[model samples]
Target chain A: MKNSIAALYLIVVAFNFSCGQDTANQVATISDTPFTPELLVEDVAIPWGIAFLPDGSMLITEKSGELILFKDGQKNTLSNVPEVYSRGQGGLLDVAVHPDYENNGWIYLSYASEEGEEKGGHTAFTRAKISDNSLTNSQLLYKGSPNTTKGQHFGSRIEFDDKGYVYLSIGERGARDDNPQDITRDGGKIYRFYDDGRIPEDNPFVGTEGAKTAIYSYGHRNPQGLIKNPKTGDIWDNEHGPKGGDEINIIKPGANYGWPVITYGVNYSGTPITDKTAMDGMEQPIHYWLPSIAPSGMAFITTDNYGADWNGSLLVGSLKFQYLELLKLNGTKVTDRIELIKGLGRVRDVVQGPDGLIYVGVEGKGVYKLVPKK
Target chain B: MKIFLTSYILAVIGLSLYFFQDPALEASMQRGNEIYADFCVTCHLEAGEGVVSTFPPLAKSDYLLQNRAASIRGVKFGQQAEIVVNGVTYNSAMPSPGLEDDEIADVMNYILNSWGNTSDKIVTVEEVEAIQK
Candidate 1:
């Protein structure tokens, strides 16, 4: 009996060793930096997205379905804003101006809308022109179908690439097993479309049978941060994982990012989602957070306003840690990470403004401009 | 024969205890734990210890234990007012989680019982349904 028990122990030990081999990748090294956050706008709740106009004015989206335009130090609540579902994690999500805003004057917004036939809400993308403190000529661009009442995973962020194509990220809508891996579904995808609502003919799944034609990439969990790297013109995103395994991935056409099938995270109940971190066809993230920072918004610093060390780095907001993380990049891999504006609040959104300064949005507070210390 | 008799008495006692125990609350808490992890854990954290001056702690929360109706109302509708939790003022808005009445009850019971908290009474679906916006 003793010998049999010893043999069983050896088998268990071997199994544990194999399982531990596929854990999360390298952890980011946090460094201290000197900076101060100056209050830009105050008394807002759950600022989800930030955008800048050509005239140095700011447009901020409050998650409870309000759009505020801050110009000349005054906060004006814009009218004709689309009504959002405004449940747990659903609400008015992201706002961005067209790359040719100076000539086209088009602004893009994403919100959780209940306009479809379904009872619940899903992410909807729309574009409008701001005129006299209200939206005019509003056009519904795209809306995800088969809405759900599940109060999680509404990955809605809007970005415009240099090529004038609009990209939107939608979460798996709490259907991890059903939606992420399926091409017919709407959620867990990065969708690309023309500035108008037309699907590009060259989209990866356009000719595929029964696939969502607008899908640029699939198998993403919940990507809240989507940005176009100004230097490479490549789209990048950062998504929240279950308990850990938050990731930063570069977007590619027709790529599978491996959500439930291969993840370093376990379920919140401390159960493993999967034992595989690397798969055959799944694209790996450039960097992933082990104990998830709950990343929300992302921006790349393109100017020398904060000196040489900050230029060409990436800025990501941490909702879980209440800090703004600055990641130094060498090509696509993150070499160093530094935490900024710690303990302010849940950093919901971060953006580089037209004035070449960084603006961060904090939940329950307001927006702050990050000023580097001399 | 003596061992058999002794085992028969032990079995009878075990069955009686099993039948008398509060199985409803036990099952509700198990479901509530899952709901908490999905909805509430992001802000309130795993152990109910919320972030300082941002999200308030639900562990041993004086506001939760003192105000029952307000707590239910906060979950039923969205909470936006200034309230004190553990002597700290938190005016942060908490959007309604859009959970069913039964789910709200289950999650409430789970929070009230775990993390050194004790409640003699269990939250029910009827109580959750009775709260107004």
Candidate 2:
């Protein structure tokens, strides 16, 4: 069309959808990222988690306590889901499939569960057998303790380690100081558990006085992103900071991550949560954000779908900024930062499909795919 | 002839509503929509269903429709005390939006009519200005 740069951006966008052949001019000017987003489906409600089945269908959880299977551009709600609290940052969130699912057929889910008639709830993880697109024989794996009416910070993302153990993160429920650092509490910790919902005896806090047996690592404010790097098999997480200091950390067993006591964040009222940023035995983050990006889901792209440059790059959804962020790493050290799919509105989750296309879910806009400019 | 004249008058009014609503109710609602997008979507949600028992749903809210002054006061001056919506008590403190009285009125108009809500009375700027803490 026109020779202007904005028009050139539209021309590449046109080719991304229509398969137009005017690529030679457009490809040279796409700034080496060569990618545009495509809408896949918007049928699911508040899609919080995404996991691909072996047959290329996707299992998605809506924050309102429903699960939908997106198959061939159609979505159908599955049956027999537990009743979720569905209150203030609490709901059905984060879904995962058993790594050895060819035999076990187990699908895992994490959601906020109502504790009683007292208007309190806690995050609960359950593993169920999905047969005929419905859950059956479900088992309660773990539930965060001391459910309260505070109604924020339900960090419940699930990642599976290579050794078939389950790693799940739970938030501090806004008790940044008390819950995060205490080993005996349920909130603000990542737990390692057997697939059958039993606590591992080797967990870091087991056999200790006044400690929860399921605690693996302690002192997280509210981690919303959890994943195992397919290349290194290390569990990494991204969490929201109070006012600033969102962080990304590589999780290690028995490690203290130093939340409220040692933080780079201040309270929402601009008061400091703590005066210290480092402590005696606590670990530090590999990457952190100031002024807070409110990150949600994250994934490491191991596919060559977008060519060599995009492979193994960490993609995280920014809720406050309404964009997807690319954190480039040169062997675990972040070297560059790029933003993509700008102004698409509050990215919620990002995952690389089996077909190597990046499937990202955004708030109110639903799920979309980011494809490299061909 | 009578019906035709009535239809013509209605058309003129509709046209005036579309093209020239500055400082009027329609203009207030338009500004309100933008203000809601900027400030309220994160906790209250896009559809205004609100978080269950926490943020208190704005869609078809009986509480908002019933307690008009309290709702205006809450938006104008931050609410920290417990309030009930649809019989569910909510205690979460809402910080003051720091918007002017006219901006509050505009956003109030936007919320009053959105997501299965319809209001017979308009929230005027003067009403918001009269609120104190």
Give the TM-scores of the predictions, in the order they appear.
0.87, 0.70
State which candidate has the highest lDDT: 1
lDDT of each: 0.89, 0.81
Can you tell me which runs of candidate 1 are displaced by over 4 Å?
Answer: A1-34, B1-34, B46-62, B80-93, B99-103, B113-118, B122-126, B129-133
lDDT of 2 by residue, B6-60 (tens): 9999999999976875557778889888777646765676788886765789999
Q: Residue A160 of model 2: what lDDT? A: 89
Q: Report the lDDT tens digits of candidate 2 across residue range A1-374.
A: 35698888988868753642222112111355667788887855467899888888888888878898889888888999988875557889999988888788889999989754545788999999887878999988888878875557889899889987898999998676679888888889998999887988888888899998888898998899998988889999999877667899999999999998888777654667788889889999887775477889999988777778878889989877667888878877776677778767667898888788889987665788887778
Q: What is the per-residue lDDT of model 1 for residues B1-133, given as tens digits with 9 covering 90 to 100?
A: 9999999999999999768757888889898898887789888988999877778898999999988889988988878888889989987778777788999999988988889887878999999998888
The chain A TM-scores for the candidates, taken one by one, are 0.93, 0.89
Candidate 1, residue A75: lDDT: 97
Q: Could you say which candidate leads in DockQ?
A: 1
User: Per-prediction count of colliding residue pairs?
Assistant: 0, 0
- Candidates' chain B TM-scores in the order shown: 0.83, 0.80
lDDT of 1 by residue, A244-362 (tens): 78999999999999998998788876788899999999999998886789999999999888888779999999988788888888899777777777778889999999888899999
Worst 10 residues of 1 chain A by lDDT: A21-30
